[model samples]
Structures are given as C-alpha cells and as structure tokens.
Target: MSVDLPVSSPTWVSAFLDLAAEELERGSAFWAQVTGTTLSAVRGAQHEFTTLVPTDGDDHLRIQRRDAGGSRVHLDLHVPDQAAAAAYAVELGAEVVRPEEREDGFVVLVSPGGLSFCFVGQRATTRSRPTSWPAGHRSRVDQVSIDAPGRLLAAELAFWRDLTGWRLRRTAYPEFHQLEVPSSQPLQVLLQRLDDDATEVSVHLDLTTDDVGAELERHVALGARVLASHDHWTVLADPGGLRYCVAGDPPDHDVPA
Candidate 1:
C-alpha cells in the first residue's frame, strides 16, 4: 500500500469545536472573539460548519453544530492525499468512522484509544499565529491534549507518534508525552496518561498565553468559568460548556521573565 502523506509533514491542523445546536450561536461568537478571529460563512451539507478566519494567517479552528452532543473537540489533519493518509492511519490502528465522507475527500477516524479525528488536504501553508489582545497579551490555541486511560496510554502514544512521525519527548509532567511538531505546524500534540478510571479516550485544548491572569479575566468576562487553577495553567469551561486551558507562557519561552 503506497500511502503518500505530506512530504513536509502536515502544516495545517483545524481543531473542530463540536457544539450542540442550541449553543452554536453563542459558542461560535465566543470562540471567534476569544481567538481573535471572525467566523466564516456557514458551510456544510446541513449548514453545520463554520471556519474561524484569522486575521494574520491561515485558518486552524472551526466550529461544528451537532444535534445532540454537549460539547467536544475533534481535529482535522490537513495532509496531501487525504485518502492515503486515512489508509495509513488505519494501518496504524485507527478505525475509519465515515468511509462515505470520502466522496468529497473527507474521512473520519477513531484512534486506538477511541478519540475521533478526520483527514483533509493540506492546503494551508502558513501557521495560525497567536492573537494580540488588550495589554499586549498574546495567546494562541496551540495544543490538544489527548487524555487516555492508563490501560490504553501505551498504545495511544504509539499510534499518534507513529502516525504523525513526530519526535516523542518527555514532558515536565510524568504522565505527559509531548509530540514535538515543527514550528510550521498549526497545533501541538500532548498525550496524557490518566488514572485507570475512565473507560474512554477524550481530548481538550490548550491555549498558550503569555499573560495567563489577563487571559483568564478576559475569558471570564466573555462567558467562561474557571474550573481549576494551577501555577502553570488554569482550566475553564467556555460559554458553550467546552473545557480548555489558558496554559501559561508558551513552551518556546523557557526562561522566566
């Protein structure tokens, strides 16, 4: 099987914020404002998809209206020969969830740990940059943390690392294995080993912000709630009830100010 994925690695990754129909309006607006983006015209078979168009670079975020789910995050890997990438992913233990979607060049898949993502052509070359806000604070939706059960962590890690061919590295947190994507790539990847409690895989996003305090306050004023706080990061639920984090100073800035 000759599956030719992008030769330079996938440059664009669009994280899809799947929200319940009732939350679409509020969620779309909230995400756009928070990320310094404008919502693109609605497009999809059922008018269920909208891209968050950024001001400085290619798009890397999208919102999807779902009929029933509360709120969830899935991503689309934009690679050349999407069909071949889907096939390659299947060979690496991913299960195709929507073969029918391939007619239009979209194919959904579930990872070994059961987290859902799909494939699309790698059309965007420029990466989405961090947004500048009041007080000159900069933040970008940078990473997606895949939370997996202890029993499945090993396989999950193997599947993602192998599938993306990214450098697998250890993180400060013992439970985390970060996949170091090239700076050209839109989103970073983190595999978190969870306590052997949950039976299913799940995902949440992280926005690397230079000023966490300001970001938190701004987000709260825009209809977000703090779930928990740590020295390095703060977790919150957005207006549409989707959870994410305002992760402290990005990884690139290793030294303290």
Candidate 2:
C-alpha cells in the first residue's frame, strides 16, 4: 500500500513530552532548563499545551498535560500536505486516532507497536541556531531511541521505514539499528530490540554530548538523578522521573564498518 509522497516536500520532525496534569509544571520546568529553552504561555481549552521556545531556532519540543499514564515522549512530523502525509501513514499500518481536514489540521496516529505520533500541516520555518551548551558542556538532543519488543522488531522497523523513508542500517550491536535521516533533518531515530518479554513499545530521548561527566553533573544540579553510568552513555531521570540518555556520538550511515 503506497501513497504518492512528493520528493520535493520537506518533513520536519519534533519531539513532545506528555505528562500527567499533576506533573506538567515540574516536567515543563525540568525540560526547559535541560534544553535551554523557555516555555510559552499555556494554550488549549484545557490549558494543556505549551511550546519550548528556543533562543535561536524553531521550537522542536513541546509539553502536554495528559489525564493518565506515566510521562512519555512522542514525535510530530510536519509536512506541507497534511492529508497526504496522514493517508500514507495509515497505509503503512498506523491507526488514525484522530483525523484532520484543514490546512492547520492535526492527525494523531499510533504505530503498529502502539507508539503514538502526529502529522501536522505546514513546515515550521523558524530554524533555531544549533544548541549552545553552557561554558563547559557540549550537548544537544540529536536522536530519539524507540524500544520495541523483540517479537515485533521486524514489523516495527518496517513501519518507521515506510513512514519516514529514512535509510536503515544495522549497528555494531546486534540488538540495535539506526534509521539515518538526511543531514538536513535535526534528529535521527534509533530502534532497539528489547531482551525482556515486554510487549509494549516505548520511546526515550537521547542527547549527544562531548563530555558525559560534565553534562551529567549539570543535569544532576538541575534535579536529574543518575540511574547508571557507562563509558559511552549515562542514564538519567529528570525531575518528572522520565529516563533519557547522554552519550558520545555513535556511528553514522557514512561511517565505515
């Protein structure tokens, strides 16, 4: 099942954190400081929506207050033609949770693995300058990692490949794969097969940093708890108890094996 996707059209992907209403303020504050961005005035009839305004580029992060479940992160794909984009995603096995019609419409979809994402009409033109870390810290959220049950790995990988058209490559680690987006895109998507029997798919954000130690320290001061430390990456939980990682750059698509 294929829908015509214009080769010339650009797609912009952004990330959003959805937290319980009770944790919205704390979660919003924590993410704002971590990303060096400010929170916009809360909008939406329920006052559950806010955007993280970066100092330079377009805001790629947002905060939403949900009624249930633990905090989780999801992606937003911005394209010029909302209808076509959403139609193609449905054809790729996504279930449409909400449909859209107007130019500024929003279509919510859940992937085969049950992970949620949205397609928004029109590209975000405001490009912020690359993130500027504090005096000693050099890091930015350059990729999002999706953890899927081992049993569903193949189907999950195929769903994302069809949706984004990003080139997929195997990593040095057998359990992990990288969906390499074009250099023009701001974020990469990593798919990791879980060893446990868990059947649900979930996502976590990752930051690439030059100095993991220094960056970890900064995060600790900002109320992030260190869960574990490894040579390549450090596991951390924010004030809202959402887990994320800070790591050195991993191999890229152009890198030789």
Candidate 3:
C-alpha cells in the first residue's frame, strides 16, 4: 500500500501537536514535583520524552511505569466524511472495522498493522479540538504503553515499523522501545512484560469519567475487580483479569519496576 499523509491536515493537527507537547511538559513538571526526579526526552524521537521520578510519594505509586505503546494508542480523526476516511484508510492498507455507533457520533475505523483508530463525526458544537492537548485541556487522550510478554521487543518493533512505516522513536532499554507517530499527540503503544500474570494479558481500556469512584462502583456492579485506587483514578481488573482504569485525569502515575 502506498501510505500517504494528506497534503493538508486539519487545522487542529498543528494545534493538537502544540497542546500535546505542552501537556507532556506539564505532566513532566507535575511528576517531578511528586518524585524529585529529572525529566528528559529520549534521543532521536521527536516529542518522545520521559521522567526519572521517585515512585512512592504524593500518595502516588513509587515507580512510574509509562511507555507509549499499547492497544489504546489510537487516534480519532475528524474527517468531513466518514466514508471518505474509511476509503482513505483502505488506500493506506489499513484494515477497516465497522463504524460503530456511540452516544455522541459514529466511529469509522481501520487498523494499520492491527493498530486501531476511529474516525468520529463532529456532532456537537462543543467538541474537543486536538490542539487543546498542550494547554492541558484535552477532550480525548490516546496513549498506549503495552507490557509485552517476552524478549520480542526488537521483533515486535520491526514488525510494526515494516507495517506502518513509522520510524523508531526510541531504543530498547531496561523498560521500553518507543515508536513515533507523525503527529505530536499521545499516540504511543507500549509493550511491557508482567510477572506471574499480575495483570491479565489482554487489551485493556482506559476511560476518563465524570467520577472515578462512581464509575468504579458501576463497574463493580458489572463484576470488575478494583485492582488499585488512588486519588486521581481507580484501576479495575476485568472479569477476565485484564487491568484497566477510569479516572478524572490522564494516567500520569509512575510505578517503579
């Protein structure tokens, strides 16, 4: 497939990139205060950064576990036409998924190399603009840092790189191997390995809800285990034991390994 980025992107792409950068910086600063560790960007990966913060402070976890790859590392593009978007994805060799219905609008999708993304409609007047990320006023946030199970970081990364044509954003270290998306937004998918199935090996989902506690309670009613809870969010392990979370804010926790 001949992958082509649009000659012109929505005005919001630039805006969103700026916002994403800001939020990353802000997140770094916030984490720094909490951990007393310095923040730094990984070399050679534009917009890819990390912090060396302490794990057990500020009621926050002692070690901050973060990487930019996982099932949730998706983007929501607002194209003028959903069908056109799907067709474009097909042109890019992405496998199209059904355009599902949501309360706000419809989601048309295509997963490039099994990485999923949605094309949502501009249904409401007050919709989230991608540029709001840097201002820390984002509407939709997507960053996935997965915990892969084996010594397959290099192989997995090479597969994705061959599949998506996205360049490597960072090298493999004790923790993660990072990939870059064209835009500045939080389009990270992490590959992590867990011990003794501490968390289930499944694609986990994270949602920003009105009330973390209330939503946690609701999921509990539906039979989800409360794995971990903090002031910012509540972690829920699904019946299948996959770990996910709902919170008032984005995931900025640092869990030391």
Q: Say which candidate scores most in TM-score.
A: 1
Best by lDDT: 1
**Candidate 3 C-alpha lDDT tens digits along 1-257:** 66654521221210111113323444434323322344544432343424232222211111122244321223445445555556655665556677544443535453433544456554222222221222233222234444444543444455444434456665545555555654433234444444433322223334454345554555565556888777665776544344565657533322122
Model 2: residues with Cα > 4 Å off, grouped in runs: 1-10, 101-104, 125-127, 250-257
Q: In model 1, where is the ten-residue run with the lowest total lDDT?
A: 248-257
Per-residue lDDT for 42-66 in model 1, tens only?
9888899999998977888899999
Q: What are the lDDT scores of the predictions, listed in order?
A: 0.83, 0.79, 0.41
Q: Between which residue pairs do clashes occur in model 1?
A: none
Ranked by lDDT, top first: 1, 2, 3
Error of 2 at 114 (Å): 0.5
| Per-residue lDDT of model 2, residues 100-132, tens digit only | 856438888888989998888646654454355
| Alpha carbon lDDT at 106, candidate 3 | 34
The 10-residue segment with the lowest total lDDT in model 2: 248-257
lDDT of 1: 0.83
**TM-score, structure 1 vs. true:** 0.91
